[model samples]
Target chain A: MYQYSNFDHEFVAQRVAQFRAQVARRLDGSLSEEEFKPLRLMNGLYLQLHAYMLRVAIPYGTLNGRQMDQLATIAERWDKDYGHFTTRQNIQFNWPKLEDVPDILQALADVEMHAIQTSGNTIRNVTADHFAGAAADEIADPRPIAELIRQWSTDHPEFQFLPRKFKIAVTGSPHDRAVTQAHDIGLRMTLQDGLRGFEVIVGGGLGRTPMIGKTLSPFVPLEDILPYLEAVVSTYNLLGRRDNKYKARIKITTHEHGIDDIKHRVETKFVKIKPLFTGEDMHILKEIERHFEPPNFKPAKPPVEAISTTSQPPAFRAWLDTNITPHKVPGYAIVSVSLKKPGATPGDASAAQMRALADIARDFGHDELRISNEQNVILPHVHRADLPQVYHALRQADLATANIGLISDIIACPGMDYCALATARSIPVAQQIATRFHALKLEHDIGPLKLKISGCVNACGHHHVGHIGILGLEKAGVESYQITLGGDAGEEAEIGTHAGPGFGADQIVPAIERLILGYLHLRANETESFLEAYRRLGLAPFKALLYPQEKKAA
Target chain B: MSVTPISKVVTANDLRSGEVIYLRFPHSWTPELSKASVITDDDLAQAGLAFAKGQANVVVGAYLSDVVAEIDGPKASHFRDTFRSTGPSNYRHGKQEI
Candidate 1:
């Protein structure tokens, strides 16, 4: 982990002190709610439906065991004894009081963390591929560049108040785990002519209007990448719509201005800003690279034969099949601890669960942990020999669900349950779907399906990119859900196309079960995933199965 | 003939604690929506909101929430208002715990 410098420590301390004073003023009637709203938002405090929600940024989704422990402490001591990990790879503490937020910020600062830019119209947490350095397919670790961007965009005077909140995602591998194509700015590290550069994708996002980003540049030289980003964001800052809040994103700007027009303007701006970056960023990256050096691997093979010979638990076998992935280093496996326990709230970790995970990171995981965008925790470097012990610990904590990419492994936003903007409840619906599927014991047979549920059109759950997407909406003052199919968040990314009418909240889970059951019958074999079946057969068969009664009525 | 408006109640989050609170009477708040006084007229609803606004020292985001007047008390007209009464269905916290 990159340790915070004295300058970084002092900067966060000063910010906390300033926000404490602001909170005091707001409470004393010195600052009106209207005035306090923006200030609170700047510090990542949102006035949610039930209480104050504090969104703390986990920069590039990287954390050490101590930081995880501190987060657990914050959850237990201040807010409710739980935290929600968001699709942006940040953690949100709901049910916090306004008076307690300053104290909470101080606790976060003690651990070199802050809630800064996790909300408001600022460059949010710069996310990276969770398995950045550990994955075998990656060319190089993407965190060094991501950390550099985090430093640059943290209260950058120029980009602080854009037309709307901007998001940036980075991935070093050809396999797009970061969902690079669905970001405001997506950077894919590529090698061209023996020189490393990025394939820049611009103006992709999911909200009221979903769009797949257009290629801004095939490759920009590594040295000039920052200048290129500045040019792109600057061009967007100038031309993005300010009149309509809904249309204020860079995606709309690119849509309205056309990619060619936007590209020409950005390149024109790039020429002017290219000279300002004077290799300081490269030096910072080298310094950051020192912190992310690979862990010394023990030369020991996993006891594969012994485990296979012994009567292993069916649940453990199921867990190994779904949750474990190949590591770049031999004898090591990346463990994805499922936060989506059956019938529980997705992405929520209790204080005890957090503590247990922290202990596991300290003991088994080289003190490094990652929060994946899929709302699960990643033990990035666990030894294969230690899997049984890790699994035992996780089972005790109720974090072992044995479902990684199955139907039960759903990504859901804190909809009307906690979010003020949500029109319907996402947690209950996700629970219903997961519990129902688990009861059926069909998830293992289903294989590699990504289901995402968003409470509203905000798409915070990354519902726009799920293989099967469920969006909750309010129709006729009752909770209604709309389903979409054929969405894929991969190297070849596409926004999901919506299926017909919205279903009642009660009708959605059974409808999804019907779609999946139809998919099984429609598939040539079990190896073909849900997305593959949907693509091969098209929506006609699935729709026919989903609403056979409706077809009969017609 | 004059038409009577739907019933309404003034509610806001307490400034100190973020608990959802309803205006039961002048300068008083209760967690129970049933204890809230309902205004059947638009002018009275506006007046109730203004009265709640004067108590800004203890509250924020004071506004009138639509409700239906029942024999027992005022009931929420929308599911959102119902959420304020029972808290989130996912967990037993806030007003739901009470």
Candidate 2:
């Protein structure tokens, strides 16, 4: 809900115009591919395995009906008739002509959107809780700060070429929905001394090397946020390893030098930079706050006509249990549209579906839309009175599959479909697993389960945080998968532990089914979720089912 | 090794409207490099920045270097260049000094 000021609008417009000319020059043989590569990356465009991929930032995963419609238009007109949402709260178009990219960017600017900083070594898209302002438990909206950071980091010359891609996440609530512990910089808004401040966690990341972040500053005052962040990032920029791309991330730096040492350095830097924080910055933050102020909210009781009377409308119950969450307002609910439907590509929405969702946002919802980190769409403020109508509309568009937090609600990257770095196909595997679980009707019976699949170590699929994580790899020209158990993406989050050995692509689906059966067999009745059972029973029982011969041999 | 097929890629910040010939593979473009072209300065430097003229079109324009057999629907091929085709073969970063 962050609105752009006239200055912000003009800045974005000027940028669009500047890039257009640059594109023209390159096509006219004035700029070579080498010369244009980094420039293009800054704009979140990548040439992957099949076509150009444009990653549009959903800064803190916030959008409105108009923005959604703009995305639909881009999908329909510029490239393929589909758009793929990503784990970083961004959307990617898998197929677009290089010649049309500038025009596509121009179109985005028309709607006050851009693909800026969605890629490259710069401060990538700043992500936060998708249910930021609307969540019932949030202390305050994180977007105002997220938007402030977006403005501060936009075209920021100082940190443009960092040692590696830097990510920042913000969570306003005690329950970290933004996955704060796994970002380069994680800001948790908390109350300190009866004043709102932040618990700054540093150097958390997932990829080839997974690390849980460390507390850099236990409590940083609200006024000192920008300066403090600048200190942290610039310090890392100076000290972070530049020799290896794999090791250059601040996570590695934090790991190598120790968080205490890093914190000391950042504190020293913050002291030096603290004076630069003028009232102007505070004024800007206040101005941005105006854009994010909750819309004129009317108090209403829960709609009497609608209540979840069905304790066992499996689909409805599943949705209520997983997809819908308690809103901050009465009689309103935040609806999460799961993209993990069987046989459907993760995070992909067709142009028509986008249009439908846009219409839904305008009519039933508060014209507010959010792209979730789990590769789903969100109707942030839907009235209880409009639930049935919204459900029916979503059902018509194939968006009403109510498996939100079940195993079917998987997070998968584009994998071999679009990413040049992918070793094997991930989306297909996610689809197969979802379809199988749906067919078995084991989703609800299994209780809340998160099955995340990533094409490679790059945790775009968010496999690092799933209750059951599947990582796709290539071995000798064949696709193979490794499974990890006990990962969680929520407040009590933990990265999963790998199961014994890898399974061939052919063996993965049946292997998953076997794992589920093992769960059912070992579970202490149906009351426990998959994560609880896994935590209680440990990997021994699941390993026994996966490799009986290996245990027998042992 | 057989010569791997290659395609041209351009960022959304580098594309313009109107009739423009571009190529695509079955799912995504090639690696960071490999038969890629900026074709325009904007395409090269458009990443992490906003589009100038249009809604930001990230695209690839290439003719199939080799005749690719279609394995999926529409005009796309499963053929890919090997790891040898890493980085921009004909391009380098920072070629455009400020």
Candidate 3:
């Protein structure tokens, strides 16, 4: 975890104080709603359908036990007893009172966290792979670069009011857990000729219009990343359309002006900015790297035989199979605490659950915690020997769900339930789907499925990248769901293809059931996953299954 | 022939609490949609919205939403408003909690 410097602490505290005064002014009638709206949004406050939502950034999805404890405290004291971890790896308190947001922010700043740049048309939270430093396959920890970007982009004067909100994702592994391809800017850390650099991707986004990012530069040296990124964003700031909010993203800009032209413009800009950076950024990066140094690892053998001989519960074995990921260390494991319990709202963790997780992290997981973009918590450095203890603690908190890459592990946006922009409810549908599948006892059998639901075309759920994507929309005064197939959010990222027509809310769960069941029959073997099968076959088979009545009529 | 006017109600989020509130008769707000003043006349609805918007110190983003007048009160004509009237289906927190 990157420890906040004194300068960082002062900056965050000052911001909180500034926001508190702004809130006071607004409350006292000195600043009108029109004047205060942008200000509030800049500080990550939004008046949603039912209440104000305060989105607090967890920079690069990294935090410690103390920070997590403070988050739990804030949740219990101010907003609802729980918070929603979003796809961007930030946490959103949905029912925050407008008057209490300042206090909430102060609480956040106490733990060296702030909601600054979480919203507004500024560079949002710079997200990296949740398993960045811990994953076995990673070439390097991407957090240092992510932290560097965070430092540069936070309150960057020129980029504050860009054409649209900018998002950046970095991943250190060959496998893309950060969904780098679907961000405004994607940085994949790579080693070439014994020198570290980034494979720079520009203009990938998922919304009304989904586009896989284009490779702007195959490899830009580590030292030149900031300038290169400045070049990209600067080019986007000028070239991105402001005439239409719908087409204002860098994706549309890249689409309209071709990747080559954009690349040329960015290259031109990069040349101008390269010399201006000096080495201050590198110095800061070196200091940041020291803070992220791997924790001292103890020489311990894998607890496979010990656990196997203990007559451990079958549920523990199941959990070990699903929730645990191979860690970089010899006898360590990355335990993903599933927030999506069946019938519960996805990404929501109660204060009690949060505290439990904080404790688990402290006792077993080296005090480091991570929030995955998949809306789960990660105990990045849990020793394999302590797996049983960690599992037991998680079970106590109702966080031990043995469905990591299974069907029940769905990603859903707040949708109409909490989001003002949502046209239909997403949480209920996700809950229903997860519950239905859990009842069937078929999730593990179904195997490695990504079912994501977005309340609307905004695609907050990353529905565009799910193996099975459900997008909810309002049609004829009713909620209608549109399903897509073959979408992937991996090294080979691709936008899902629509499977024709839409289903009513009542029909969606059963429809999904038919689709998955149909897939089981259609797959080449039991080992082949849903996405692999979808790729091997096509949408035609899934379409026939999804809308069987239409197929029968035809 | 005179066309039947669609019933409407003035709605906004409370400035301080951010709870969904509907404008009542004269100059008051209520979280309950049933307690809201259902204006059948378009001009009156606009006026009510304007009035709600003018109460800037108390409310934000005031607008008119369509409603169907029943014997007891006005019911939200749209699902979105219905959600605002009640609360999110996933949780019993906002208006539903009250």
User: What fraction of the reference interface contacts is present in each model, in order?
Assistant: 0.81, 0.04, 0.94
| lDDT tens readout by residue for model 1, B1-98 | 98657889999998888888899766678988999988887888888899888877788889899998889998999998899877888999888675
User: Interface Cα RMSD for all candidates?
Assistant: 0.9, 11.2, 0.6
lDDT of each: 0.90, 0.78, 0.93
lDDT (Cα, tens digit) per residue for candidate 1, span A487-554: 98899998887888989988998899989998889999979998998888888888887788988998
| Distance from true location, Cα of A447 in model 2, Å | 1.1
TM-score, predicted candidate 3 vs. hidden true structure = 0.99
In candidate 3, which residue ranges exceed 4 Å CA deviation? A301-305, A308-310, B1-3
Model 3 over residues A1-554: C-alpha lDDT tens digits? Answer: 78788889999899889989999999999999999999999999988999999999999999999999999999999978999999999999998888888899888888889999988898999999999899999999999999999999998999999999999999999999999999999999999999999999988999999999999999999999999999999999998999999999999999999999999999999999999999889999999999999998777766545764548899999998899898998888899999989999999999999999999999999999999999999999988899899999999999999999889899999999989999999999999999999999998889999999999999999999999999999999999999989999998999999998889999999999999899999999999999999999988988999888887798
Interface quality of candidate 1 as DockQ: 0.82
Chain A of model 1, TM-score against the native?
Answer: 0.98
Per-model TM-score versus the true fold: 0.98, 0.86, 0.99
- The total of clashing pairs for model 3 equals 0
lDDT of 2 by residue, A288-394 (tens): 89888786665676653355766435556556667788889887889998776777887889899999999999998878899888889999898876776788789
lDDT score, candidate 1: 0.90
Highest lDDT: give the candidate number: 3
Query: Best DockQ goes to which candidate?
Result: 3
Q: Regarding lDDT, does 1 or 2 come out ahead?
A: 1
lDDT measured at residue A430 in model 1 versus the true structure, 0 to 100 = 94
